[model samples]
Target: MKKKLGAYLTNRKIMATALLALTLALSACGNSGEKANEGSADKETRDITIKIGYQKYGTINILKADGALDKRLSEERNIKIEWIEFPGGPQLLEALNVGSLDLGHTGEAPPIFAQAAGAPLVYLAHEPASPQSEGIIVPKGSPIKSVADLKGKTVVLNKGSNVHYLLVKQLEKAGVDYKDIEVKFLPPADARAAFEKGSVDAWVIWDPFLAAAQTATGGTILVDGTDVVSNHEFYLATRAFAEKYPDIVDILLEEADKIDVWSKDHPQELAEKLSPQLGIDVESLLLAAGRRNYGVQPIDEELIKAQQAIADTFFNLELIPKKLDINDAILK
Candidate 1:
């Protein structure tokens, strides 16, 4: 009876130990599974950040000041925006090239130059040609009355800028060879300083700089982009970013369109709002705002042809190292 009891107790101990070990193994698996699920959830809810490059003026600036983009993206998509200011489109596109910027706005010529340099850029949308928004100007009292007068004279402009096409076309139309005029490549601020000091005979510039220059220095317009280039303001994104987050791009465009509509209807109000930010007086801001064409349009075949023309002109002039197909950089 003692042996039987002892054997029975030994059996009970073995069974209890086995059950405990099995329970511990099952519990360990359950904890591991829970941890795996938690990691996946964290990935699904990861936050994204978009870095935007913008100039001191234009729709992007207005968008930044408006706060609509920030609010909507933050609340809806858990996305954050970082705005970076560039001196000019060329600089902005350079930032886009090195992966520093996800999106940026520029005039028509910058993208052509950027694409030629192998920047992976995609055109998203464009503001209509505001012909009067850009021009070739001289000091108020200068005798350089027309574009024809620019022959053999010093002209300052931002190189590879939207106004570059304007200068070329304007010179061509006026029967002056591009090489006949002395061209000084400078950003707007430096170009403005040169213009004010009479160091350059003429300055080709775009507004609100154009407007500000006229007001500040009493410069006279030799020729605006009226019958020349379209002077379209383009919104561009890195090809990778556009492809990966198209929905974010769409939201940005939608918000920009809303601002454009409001800007068109409320020029005075827009000027007043931008005055302090731009540090320009309301009068000049109003002047710049007045002539601006305020609508974002999709890229079309006609627009592509226009852009291609600019590219071809640059290639022919040997401004770019190689010929570029504008369509390749365009977003499909």
Candidate 2:
């Protein structure tokens, strides 16, 4: 009876050990499943749609319509391209600041205002100044022959834009006090309407609006940005995005460079392509395309200094809320 009891005790110990081992094995399998799910979740986070913001007035639209960027980026990395349209640079930068846009392009002044507004931004590349692309224009047969003629006259412009600086510099150059001009702040569409109806004596605008306005209203250029502001177009990304996904930044720059070259080489084709997409006349699109400098360049010290000057100009005029370091916005 003692031997049988001892044997029973040994069997009981063996059963307990087997049960413990089975429980551990089941837990291990569960852990492996969880880990596999976690890995998949991480990959989903990494491979996401890249959101790009662009305005209607530039070559970015041309690139978008071409579908090259979509094919190249999507096929190469299995990523998706999402394009967001903005009315103007200021609006685009606003979206960028709010985390809605990861990448965008804007004029020199928009980035300055964006940085002053405490937006985390980095300048990725620049389009050389296309001075002729923007102009302070007057209606046909209007008496406003010169920038000085704009004094005491209601002049309409898009506030906080590249042309804003142009208006300021042109006024200063003409010895017309900026305070003397009855400035009407409006977007391109409204300003164009005002210009045509003779409600506004002058309209300061950029391309294709400049081209469209001139074509539609027979307006003449009073003064363009030839010797004044660079009117440099800037490609920007969130500082966080730039730091986190530098490889993507390189891809963007590469694609942009290719588009720039293509646009320059095929102005007529570009105009034809953009005409229907933008709903503007082909002639106007051609004129707008011809004047623009579609060349993409890396930021240099000279460009940085030029940008800083714009920042200082706006701050001194109390246009922007405060002064900001342009260098802070440049990617290292």
Task: Please give the RMSD to the true structure for each candidate, in Å.
Answer: 17.3, 16.7
Return the top candidate by TM-score: 1
Give the per-residue lDDT digits (tens) of candidate 1, residues 6-26. Answer: 353355456545754655555
The TM-score values for the models, in the order shown, are: 0.87, 0.86
lDDT of every predicted structure (CA atoms): 0.87, 0.81
For residues 4-102, what per-residue lDDT tens digits would candidate 2 score against the true structure? 423533554465457546555555678775455543322342457988998876756777988888887777667788999886888888898999999
How many collisions per candidate? Answer: 0, 0
Q: Residue 200 of candidate 1: its Cα lDDT?
A: 98
lDDT of model 2 at position 201 = 90
Off by over 4 Å in 2: 1-46
Q: Model 1 RMSD to the real structure?
A: 17.3
The Cα RMSD of model 2 versus the native structure comes to 16.7
TM-score, structure 2 vs. true? 0.86
> Candidate 1 at residue 275, lDDT?
89
